[model samples]
Target: MIETSTSICEVIAKLRIAREAPYYGREYAFGELWNALDRLDDREADDESR
Candidate 1:
């Protein structure tokens, strides 16, 4: 899901950059998103290994 993650990351990055972004105001959310994506990737990898 590289395409999906890339697109989402782009939008999230944009939001994180804007000071007026309500949800993105908490910068930790950005890292959380990355972590979540990593977890999803790991899960997918595990599934593929099965």
Candidate 2:
């Protein structure tokens, strides 16, 4: 759980950094971050359903 929390925090930080950037990579980074969060949400939902 600690590791997962840490990873989520890291992804959030990356999202913030990407949002601040003024380049083309920002969109890609945001997409990746969104996907990561989506996966995490799916996992949590599955866990809850179980």
lDDT of 2 at 8: 84
lDDT tens digits by residue: candidate 2, 1-50: 66568668867887897788779888888887888788678766776787
Model 2 segments more than 4 A misplaced: 2-7, 20-22
Q: After superposition, how far is residue 28 of candidate 2 from its true place, in Å?
A: 0.4
Using lDDT as the measure, which candidate wins? 2
Worst 10 residues of 2 by lDDT: 1-10
Model 1 steric clash pairs: none
Predicted model with the maximum TM-score:
2
lDDT of 1 by residue, 1-50 (tens): 67557656755665555535467455765665666567667766776887
Candidate 1's error at 34, in angstroms? Answer: 0.4
